[model samples]
Target: MFGEYRTLSAKPGYSYTYTDGWTLSANPVYSYTYTDGWVYHGRSRYSCESVIRIILAETSLRSTVQREDALNNKIRAAKKLADIDSNSSQLRQLKQLEKELEKLKKTRADQVRTLYEWECMLRVGSLRRGYISVKSNPAWYLREELVEDCISRGGCCSRDCGCCERRRLSAKNGKGIGHCTLECMCCIHDQGSEFTAEEKKDFNGRFGKMLRSNNPAFLLRITNAYFSKPLFWKIKTKHK
Candidate 1:
């Protein structure tokens, strides 16, 4: 149940009229539905609508950090928030990230006791591994909507240089990958900066909010993207 790249209508009360004739209106508090059991089963992570999670989590460079620290501090699990320094940056380094990721998977496997409910409450990490890791094709990762999401946030994808589509990560050994990360060179070149640890946390947290949010398409994207075998349910977000 991966998401296809579609131009998301962001006007008031965006609606999705699926091919099966179900009309869904999207609101931040919108929800995902099972819809006659047209759903994927026995999957742990990844939505079929894969566009690379880094863009979703790294955020556009134009992002401004809200003073969520104060708000988060009030929560019982705020320290966990404080302790987070987004590993999204490390993900860009390619070779450096393998061992760290393997360790994380094992840890996540343990913590996924009640999957969906747990994710809804607090989504700390991202599902960066798409359904397939094609290793370096911009076309593979370039879901334009995601690029637009990056552009909206003032990332390198927003630029005319085509950096987002360039194979810069591991190109020599034929494993070169593309797409923007928190530490993209062009992004750092133009913006003259990379995300600070807190900024990356804030950036990553914003995407986490989307997963935890009620936006139907968004929730569906995440649920499909990061499915954890938890019980799925319908969340009604239609307005009267």
Candidate 2:
């Protein structure tokens, strides 16, 4: 089980995970300047604020992906059940769910395109007061709380189904192998219930609470880890 965050290292490109434990943050560091060729392209300039916003958007986009993904899996599970026990009401519900999922997929597509463009705009970027340097761990979301929370959300972690341990590369993540999201079909199938609007609001609150003003360092650390875009946090020599 992975531990929660611990102290941050002073190094510009690395963080400590308790060595056998964990924590996170970064100190003030150099910033970035766009290269001349980048300017020649007449692209809108990048800023530290812009980068932060992009990272936040990435987090939100992942939520969108997870929602749709969960719904998609639920549809599959529903279909299987419908096959076993045919019900016109169930079939109709499945159709409606499929429709909703398509809408979400379209929204996700739009976000993905916009995010890709923004990321390209600042693909070569950095921080003002610090840098993001999460190590290359094939498995992210190792924090014990994240997994435990998964069970709380009725994820498969609570059972021998082994879904949480499946080394999943969720549509919700780019490079991290992590626990189940609202998207775990096994959990939804077993529970026979979906997340309510209030619960989803609560989950969103908990998920993004770290970004509060009181914990800006954590914001950077999570941003770095989730987006897997540390190269953007690298310090660049003043672009000549």
TM-score of each: 0.38, 0.52
Error of 2 at 121 (Å): 3.9
Q: Candidate 2 — which residues are off by over 4 angstroms?
A: 1-51, 84-87, 126-193, 205-209, 224-240
Candidate 1 lDDT tens digits, 155-178: 666677765554443332322233
Candidate number of the best TM-score? 2
**Poorest 10 consecutive residues by lDDT, candidate 2:** 35-44
Candidate 2 lDDT by residue in tens digits, 74-181:
799889989988789889889999999999878877887776666566545333211223324434444344455555655566667765555444434552234555
Model 2, backbone clash pairs (residues 3+ apart or across chains), number: 10
